[model samples]
Target: MTKAELVFIPFPGIGHLVSTVDVAKLLVDRDERLSITFLIMKAGVDSKVDRFIDSVSAACKCIRFIDLPKDEHDPNQPILLSFIESQKPHVKEEVSKLVSHSELSHDSPRLAGIVVDMFCTSMIDVAKEFGVPSYLFFTSGAAFLGLEFYIQALHDEQKVDPTEFKDSDAELVMPWLTNPLPAKLLPSFLLHKEWMPVFLGQTRRFRETKGIIVNTFEELESHAVSSFFKGNTPPVYPVGPILNLNRDGDHNPRSDRSNKYKDIIQWLDDQPQSSVVYLCFGSAGSFDMDQVKEIACALEQSGHRFLWSLRQPPPRDKMEPPTDYVNFQEVLPEGFLDRTIEIGKVIGWAPQVDVLAHPSVGGFVSHCGWNSILESIWFGVPVAAWPLHGDEQFNAFQIIIELELGVEIKMDYRKELFF
Candidate 1:
């Protein structure tokens, strides 16, 4: 049989890359005829991503990783968007080389398609040049993708900007959702006029792809997934809960940060089953000192067995890897840690999935990132959501208000999402 191949261009983030690789693993495992090549974009500031690539390479012979040369970033456009756009030429170059190689090798697979991450829609041009079908891999749930489509159509139908109502307290009756979603609750990108066009533009390009493969299933988002089937849109494939479950093999290998959270896990081993409340925001999720103090106070007052994954706020002026607070005492209320020492343990950047999966973990007070939400559901740990940013607010809305699966700490991302 002739070989078949698919090229993957995941967004420049570890989570997106991991999920994309997971999809590739599923594909190759199901059909031995197929092999996938990942055109890895240089994104992260550290070696964490590189280490993941190395580990995955060792584990999967069917997958290939080609790191593209670092392109000069465009300062005028949005950072992530600009970075992705700059890689177009590099991606095209790599794909061309692949075509050349395949042409020379009798056994090499014929290029079947290209899979572009949702944010990397710009790379569709490369697929068009190669005469290959381009499928969009959406890392978030179908509900959020539906919201993007809804917002785009909503703006197009009225020929009005949704940001016009940014100041008012208004709700939108969206087709994908069972109830009206508050305008205030839409992702912050849609609320601001500056970012509105950028995100809406990306959403518009989604329709241009051959199909969209969402990291979700119909059962998880029946309404939203159904909406995709209603329109004359591209085919939708809900092949998800696509996650990297091999925590033991994760490149971190529990080498760098494992020591940090081992004590917390040991403490959890002593706790009763379903007795500890686990509070952790996603990797990018963090709070200001005021929010931290309020959380400590609440945990102190409740006297519940808790394991809090406390983190420090990011640099005010720049985006970088997560910065867990230097000292919990500096951020927490004075003496709060000592008083609650018996009942709780606050650790920096807890192994979130591990913590959530623990039998002792009864509940998750989460930032409601789509991934965090999925992990919580997967573990059968209930969630009290406080959406931090981006599509998180929308995710929180979907689970809490639409699906009735979770409760809300607050609907406002601007305010404290504390207990």
Candidate 2:
């Protein structure tokens, strides 16, 4: 009997790619009879993405990575929407070509299906062309998906104008949702027409997929999940928290690149068991100079030992962090390093999973990305959610308000502090 072949196409973002990689790892581990191929966009192959691919490939023998050419327009540039629109055709073509070639090999396992990120809806047609089932992977929770679907229905009913909803002080209540959701709590991106088009377009494509996989547990969001599938017969799998499945592996990787911040691990080792806090806002979240200073002050006052990952803001011309800001600690609050020498550690970047898993680490101050939220929960660590932007607000809402897993921090004009 031939093994089943599956191709995973993840959205070109850190959180989405990470969650998708976890699912891919899980699929291959459950059954050796499955072979997996990961289709990565050319634009998504950055240093971080490459590192992740290497880590997963090392652990899973049945997994492979296939890179496609990035769109001609830079993915990091300001005109992101234009780039995605222009790149859609190429993405479809490349994926179809790969599937066709894979089918030609006599020894190849039959193509079982394609698993696509919710954002990568362009691949649905290609899956149809190849006569294979395609599944939509919503890298977020069921609540957010329910919100998007409701918004789409409202738009179709002509009850709401996407542009007017941006400023209208109306609170949207969707009784159909399993949980009580307010329009105000919907993803902030939906407020604008430009962003609405992207999401709504994706949602339109999502309805066409054969099935949907949400990265959550049935026990965690049963109400929302139940409401989501009430009428829709498509298969829904709540096969998570996926991060819990890989807790046994040793994640440390040795490299010549000495993490200029090795003191973090040493500090963590010194702390009392479950006494220290780990603070990280992910790679994309940023704060202005004033906000940075305020946060530094708050961490100093918190009186608990901490490991704070700070990144300097990008230069005016470039999207990448300024070269000089690479040494992040020097710019911190005056005497910040000297004052907290025994209790606090500052690193530009640390192996997040390893840090979170450490025996002494008890709490996380996070940007509330779904992957980070699930990881914290998987490790049984409480969180101090401080979502800065994007779907983080939604993720934080679910974890802090809905699940009662953590505390939410309010940002005041004076400083960034946790209560």
Candidate 3:
């Protein structure tokens, strides 16, 4: 009898990779007979992502990493969907080879199926080529999945242009959702003609997969999860609340880094239980100097202890990092850090999961990344939804308006207003 194995192909982004990796770990844990092969798209070199992969591979022998063939795509390209679309041929080739080897080698685990990230739906053809099943592992909630399908259906069947209502205040109706969705809450991709087709095509391809695996539980999005099977759609599995709990020892040990970690922990320890607020945007999030000053003023007025993970905005020349960057203090208000030294800790990067797990973290001021929102829910910390862009607007609506899990923070990036 051969061991069962599944191949996971996650989107290159860190957020997508992390969640799918969590799901992969859970699958291996549940069944010792199962193992996973994680195909990393050679998108680019990222230090944090590489460190995470190294740690996970060290911890779990059952998980393996394979680097896909690299291409010369422009790192500064504004449209990511085009890049993902171009990689289909390479992905299909790699997946075919792996599937063939699994079948041929007696010692290798038998190929069970190929699990693909929602962004990489093009791999469905690869699965069919090898006569293996394909599954979509959505990193976000089922509600978002439901919305994607609804958007695609409208585009195909009704010939509705979502971008037409980009500036409109009209409400849109959907069968799965009880409340009317505001036009502004739609994902940003719908507003752009170029990206719309890529997204819609991916959603339409969802019907071709064996099933969809979502990173949420039944209690969280019962309506959305239930709506998937209203017709002949594939089975939907909500097997998550998947978190990276054991990430403490993943980093290289350092006394200086250890001291900073201890200092932050000690600060939290001193605060009253459930009294402090933690504010962290995702890795890609940042603010201009004007916005930073306003936030500083708000924090001062609130008189609350906060741990803010701050990063400077991407360079104006292009939405990419410079070879060398200036200190965070250069972008903050003059003497701002000095005044807030006692009440706040403005760090460059933080161990987000660990920080959220802290007992003193009462509130989370988030950019409303799906992963961050789920982490807040898992830790029982309340969220102050401050969505930046992309799918965050709809996610904020889901949490603040639909489920009543969090409160929405009015975001007007250009206006300099204190909270």
Candidate 4:
């Protein structure tokens, strides 16, 4: 049988890489003749992403992994785009080697396509170099993807900048959504002109792809998924709820108290059913002291059984994962831990899927991350979205304001941290 090969260029972040790996797994599993090679790129000191290399490589024999050569990132350029562009040459070289000299290659190469991450559209040129099609892998839900299509068309094709109207209290009645989306709830990238160019450039390239593979399903987002059929957008495949249910293969961000995985589970086992509120923002989700104090105060006063996964913010401008707090006293409000000690548990680096799957977890207070939202839905836990950045605010709107699957603590709260 002839072999069909696919090259995956996922954003180096752990969250993006996880979903990208899931897609690779699905493709290879569904086809006997297909094989995928993940061209892993280096990020600034993430041991978790390294674990993905180890875990994913071991779990699936059909899938292959290749580490792209490291290069100096341009400091002036934007972080995500900058790192992706710098690896263009490495990607090109690796693809050349794969097509020409790999053991899997036959007399006639059947190179299929390149699958680039949502943020790594800069790799399209590399895909075009090989005369192969390029597909985009979107990690978010279908509703947010539709929003991007509308906003991009509004700005580029229609010649109206959406950022200019962000200050106003306007609601947009979009076809995909039943309710109006507050202009304030639009993505932070849309609200800021400086950030507009990067996202706009990406959405512009969305038109360039052979197709888009978004992580969602029709039953959950029928309106949003159906709208794509009527638009001038790329073919969108809503293959989602792509979760790593296997605990042995699950990828976690932090390494500290690795023992806490079992400990937390045991603790939850003792709690009353559906009584605990699980507050785990995305891996990079964290806050400053003032915001931490406010969260502590709320949790303390509410007196509900809670599990908060708190990580210290990465140092300013650094691209590393958030570290475990050395001292909870300095960070938490005075007497906050003691007062809430009986009702709650504070730990570092949660095994999100496992925690969400626990019966004790009643509701999730999340960063409104697409993956986390899917997990919440899968486990039948309602979300209380408190988005930090990226497409989260828009995702917050979809779940709370649009579908009403959950409530919102705040929609417009953008994180103050630069990283």
Q: Give all TM-scores, in the order shown.
A: 0.93, 0.86, 0.90, 0.95
lDDT of 4: 0.84
Off by over 4 Å in 2: 74-80, 85-103, 162-170, 175-179, 244-262, 315-325, 411-419
CA lDDT of each prediction against the hidden true structure: 0.81, 0.70, 0.77, 0.84
Which lDDT tens digits does candidate 1 get at residues 1-419? Answer: 88999999987566677778889999999989999999988754645567678778988999999988877667777777778888899999989988999999989898999999988888888999999999999999988888898889888877868787676788888777889888888877887766789888888889989999998988889888998788867899999888677752332325563465667778999999999999987666788778788888999999899999887765653435466677888888889888988889988766777788789999889888777778888889988988877788888888888777888898666532211
Model number with the top lDDT: 4
Candidate ordering by lDDT (highest first):
4, 1, 3, 2
Residue-wise lDDT of candidate 3 within 1-419, one digit each (tens)? 56988889898777788889988988889888999998887555566677778778877999999877766555454335545656778777776776678778878777789998998888788788877899999888888888888888888889999778676798888755768888877877777766677778888889999899999888888888778779566788998887766652332222243455666677788878888899877766777778888998899878899998887655453323212125767777778789888788877666778788889999999888889988898899999988876678888888887888999785311111110
lDDT per residue for candidate 2 within 1-419, as digits (tens), equals 67688888886665677778878777888888898888776543346666667767776779888776665665453344444455567656766665677679767677788898886777777678778899999888777777777778778776676657543456566533434443454565666655677777778787888888989887878777777667553667787786634422222422333344355566777899998888888766566777778888988888888887777655444323222255555677778888988788777655677788889999999888777887898788899888765667667767876788999784111111110
Q: Using TM-score as the measure, name the better of candidate 2 and candidate 4.
A: 4
> What lDDT does candidate 3 reach at residue 160?
91
Measured by TM-score, the strongest candidate is: 4
Q: Please count the clashing residue pairs in each candidate, in the order shown.
A: 0, 0, 0, 0
Compare candidates 1 and 3 on lDDT and give the better one.
1
Q: Per-prediction RMSD in angstroms?
A: 2.9, 4.4, 3.8, 2.3
Residue 334, model 4, lDDT: 84
